[model samples]
Target chain A: MKVFLKLALFYGIINVFIEESLFNYPEYFPKTKYDFSKNNLSKTKIELGRMLFYDPILSIDSTISCESCHSPYNAFSHTDHRLSHGINDKIGKRNAPPLFNLAWKSSFMRDGAVNHLDMQSLVPITDSLEMGNSLDNLLYKLKKNQKYITMFYEAFGDSTINLDRVLKSISQFELTLISKNSKYDRFRLGEDHFSDQEIRGYELFKKNCSNCHKEPMFTNYKFENNFLDINQVLLDSGRFSITKNSDDFMSFEVPSLRNLSYTYPYMHDGRFSNLFEVLKHYSGPKFNSVSLTEKETIDIISFLLTLNDKEFILNPENKFPVNKLLK
Target chain B: MSNKFEKFAATCGFFFKYFISFLFIFFTYNLFPQENIEFQATFNNEATKLNKNYSIRKYHFNIKKLKFYVSNISYYNRKNDEIFTDEKVYLVDLNNPKSLKIKSQINKKSQLYSFDLGLDSVINVSGSLGGALDPIEGMYWAWQSGYINFKIEWESNMCSNDNNQFIFHLGGYKKPYYNKRTVLVKKRHIHRLIFNLNKFLKKINCDRQMIMSPSLKGENISNLIVKSFEFKK
Candidate 1:
């Protein structure tokens, strides 16, 4: 009996340790806007979501997956492609934004159309240019698969796979993508020191870019009109499409500056291939314009590079689960 | 032998407890009579069946789909005192007979006076709901995160585009374009709440048949939908 009690105590400590490790961000970051109480994070659910994220079965034709455009290597943001490419080589209207630190965001998409992370996947799944699949069709396919059935049962404690469970599980995996291990984070923690150029760049960044981009999380999580002349072809009318308000006509969700090195081909339309173009646009004729010299832009770029979380980008846990997914 | 006997006794006690609770619940449920309130979609005072051709104002069309959400049902007694309220949202689809009827616990003396034509703002932002509110139900708009309050699909020669299709998916939970309307009716119309599409179809401007997104048009149509609801005499 004493041996059994000791074993129970040991098991309890291990369980607590695992649970605590499930979600962890820096203490300096603001409280997450996502209500975790609605769909509490669990290891099984996250693993299931990871499989779903990597699997192409989520698409209508078993061709495109979330990872297809939002590749984990490019900090979960596709590079080279100006606009997101979906099944049948159909081009999406907007760039596939990088996925990280999503819990802090109250809304999703470039237009801030999706009000919740749980519902974000539905947009991509059903969009005719994207996956071109419906929730019912996706659920039907998932239910037919033996692997998904077992995963659903393990994640939800039932084999009955519904739309809510599928969406919630996908969100669980996305919420785990908290990029808080950048060089700037270490600098804040007093573990690292910045060089003279980096320090100057940091100061410049604080002065010019911190208002919309903000701190720690690197985004104020608000929409901004960055003054990219609307593409005559795409003619995307950003947040105005969702809210139908005139003020939001050119406004788009301000993206986070984290993992800038990996996530290139920036902006809503992926018009800028590098940081120089983006800076130039800001310095040009635009609302809330900032005038910056060549040296100032270079210095700011150096500081922005420090926001790249190398550890997060290369983290094997965030990558495809080859072993489990294959099995 | 004693351990086996104790296990058997414990199992029996568990069953006995559940049995007693079940009996109490059964009796309690039977004590109060439940009421059935049904939403019927009608055209010219007749059941509106899907794919049936109807003519109105030189436009001959058949409704391919008609679905709407009826929520926040409240019943009032003679003195206008709130007797019972049902917070459950019912999705009434022309294709599905099972979803047309809503079961509520109400005193026979009470009558439903008013109900919401669509899901409220709270449920709109709640995110990833199950049952009738689930996105798989096809009532949810994928582009914008909100439940479609009402949907109308028609195949008509009046529409100039897309194989002569006229569709209206009216819903917006946000401010300035809030489309959820409160539908009020006479107390006598409680049992069989009717939505006559003849009154609504006459108002549809065939020139702009596609109102898929939330706009002033959707808001205006939502108001017209509220006006279309009438209690059966």
Candidate 2:
């Protein structure tokens, strides 16, 4: 009896420690690209990150936070606008990308500018045309918040706000935005079945778009010259602007095909509003590039619809975190 | 009554021992410092004259800071007869070659040392936060939505009507464009490679102000920097 009691106590303590230390996800995914070893995730950190995502404190004049462009309902992507709107009603060049399943992404943004998730938030916070806020000023604002101070201390042992802690906290929350419960994922896991049309669409997608879109995670994460003509006004050369390689002319990051239903205004510039428009663009003379066939384009669009995961978008966990913040 | 008392005592004693063991494990894991090395990145421009043709009147060169946490830094001596090892090596000031310093943090009980480099060791040791947070790094180019890890800007008279300017923004962190380079230092020789920024400038003959993104140039600046790194005796 004494031995059993002692064993029970030991197990209880171990369980508490395990629950506090790490986050475990499903087994089907690849190893995460974000190095969590440097910035350990805690419950408080995730909460703080979520609050920051919803708060506009990150922007200049406190007008826009990450949520301004990436709303929760739209899978953390803006729905109404083609391009992202920044502080002082300024408009950015590219469309805001949806946020989800970030752990698998090796880079951030449509251009793949950031290599680490911990550093991804800096892009919107500092762009002169974006948020237009400096890091030091943002830290000062975070420090002023009594709630943030307590939360930061809880998440990172000390409330002392710095760039690393702020970035890491936001990363922690973003990592939790995993969208695995989609109908497509259910079909993959044998939990559900697809209709005949959906199955045909899946087959067509595998044949044509899977080369770029891939499986489970919808992107091969490669930059390809998708053959979209350069916008004379934006003059956005896509990947060519970064690499300076002529071959990369008109190349863009292959975005994930998931959440097509909610994450509308597709493409890098959000030129296409619906899947049909996207199909039309792919099939039309606009795509003068040597990439796709008409039939293949239709199939790829059909397959993209299957990527939508309603359960993820509706999850209350990822919602505004109002209760926690209010306290 | 005596037997019951003895059983209670035994259970309490067992619980106490387990609690102590648990505390030990918890404290040791959290308190112990794992081995890590600190690295610094510095930027410098050694160009004396701006090329007229390239529109580059002055060149501004900066090195992006990076930290490589290694278990040990060991090399073979000149004769290759023996191996000399330093457990910790830090990446020091990357911009200023003269200010770059790598120190080994030594473990008192073992052959381990903490390695640190540069003046802003702590800040540089932290990681890259894209364009929003830090501006000094120049890791972001908003029009492209990616980072230009290394940027060199120069004033030139090549392209512009008025002895104009030339700019080469070297960047691209993603696939087919990831520009991180590696270098190998031989045991005893000073291996140095010089970047001929002037050569690229000489091509245009100071006629047009050249605004060139290195990503567009297809030139490997990483290769230039890696080759330029030499081993000092």
Candidate 3:
């Protein structure tokens, strides 16, 4: 019994470090949907993953990284370009969506193609228009790097690198991108006050927008056709390409409104450049249900600005761990 | 002193007997090796020649690219008990004939056994485990988080499209579109499972060439592909 107690004590101490690297959200936020049991967290793995996220070694030409498309600032999304450019100056079809509070998400991609966060990296990594690197080749390249060798050892308890570990570690780092620190979050926690315009906008948001872009997480994560006319040039059929369901035609995943201030050039196609334009587009006759007068639209835009978590964007923890990167 | 000598001798006799028996079993075990059967997959009785045009039910086609996955390979004994074996997922590329061979280290062997054509729903959803199932193989569907179990790209005059292309991306881990199929084989220790693509394409009307999703059509073709693999006699 004493030996068993000693063993239990040993495990208890080990679990503390493992469990500490978890979703560090405020109490006001809803329960996360990420299943922690499948992929357990550890500080070493998350840090390694953060390093991997910032490192261009994951790319074929060592030019682009996960951070290239999903920048640490700008809410981990590219705001300058309407469409994400890849290696050798190749432009991709869709805009790279902002990534945060991903633990609560059920599906990924603007089209809801990737179901798991761990599996999400594979798409961009393998896409010829994007990274243009095979998982085998990427693994081979990372395996050759001594820095990654040490990091993989520290993260996985062995120097050997595999796809599962690499992907899961990336997922771990992405899972820590919790953004429950905005003025809206403070209001929920009773730590701050909102302006009357912000309050009115919040009320309007609850009535009209909250159905698709649900509360707290700010997304229901389901594909819906907002009746955007198909781009005759691109001929991108959105969710219809994946599901082949006629109802899914011209539909897109309801993007979270969090950090809209940083992640500009909005919509799946990056059509709208600002919140007011987005509001005007949504308020059109196609979406008569979201009828908003000019003042209400501005008020709503003001409320959206409150969703931008500056702390999250500038957080040092989410950036590359190494001071100097390999050229 | 005499009794002590007798005891020592008795102990020596016992040790020698056991040592001789151990050596006998060890040498015999080494002499006769357990079966480690390697299956070499071929398409229509040919791998290298498959890039050429072939006819199936009066429909002629030439394989531009042909690749598929075979997983969960194991051997079975006469008693119907599964021989414990290392689980391996093999990505077979008919274009590269060298990639067709799959070796399995198995115990409790028999001549007759079956294997999975593609990863089951479990491995399909479990995320990357490297090797054949790795996303690098181009077999994985990033959009839907599953694998394209079987793929065949060909140019056939039977296809009505201008390109005369017949592309089949058979996949789906979900119900009603589950694409994994099992094939039972016998008659040889080193199995030669023939994947007759002609039989598969014939099931689907040549006019309807493209199948890139999990649907009733894909499921029907996948079933036909399973039946198409002939065990070499």
In DockQ terms, which candidate is top? 1
Ranking by lDDT: 1, 3, 2
Candidate 1: true interface contacts recovered: 0.85
| Docking quality tier of model 3 | acceptable
What residue pairs are clashing in model 3?
A: none
| lDDT minimum window of 10 residues, candidate 3 chain A | A318-327
- Native-referenced Cα lDDT, model 1: 0.87
- Please rank every candidate by DockQ, starting with the best: 1, 3, 2
Cα shift from native, residue B71, model 1 (Å): 1.2
Q: How good is the docking of model 1, by CAPRI class? A: medium
Model 2 misplaced stretches (Cα beyond 4 Å):
A1-27, A285-303, A324-327, B1-76, B80-233
RMSD of each: 5.1, 11.2, 6.0
Candidate 2 residue lDDT tens string, A1-327: 999999999987775575345456556867777666566666788888999888888887998989889988999999868999998889999999999988788766776655567667877898887899877788888889998888888887788877767877888889888888887888878888887667777887776568888877889999887767778888988766556678878888898888988888988898888887776765567555425566656656666777788888888878887886556
lDDT of 1 by residue, B25-56 (tens): 89877876666778888877788889998887
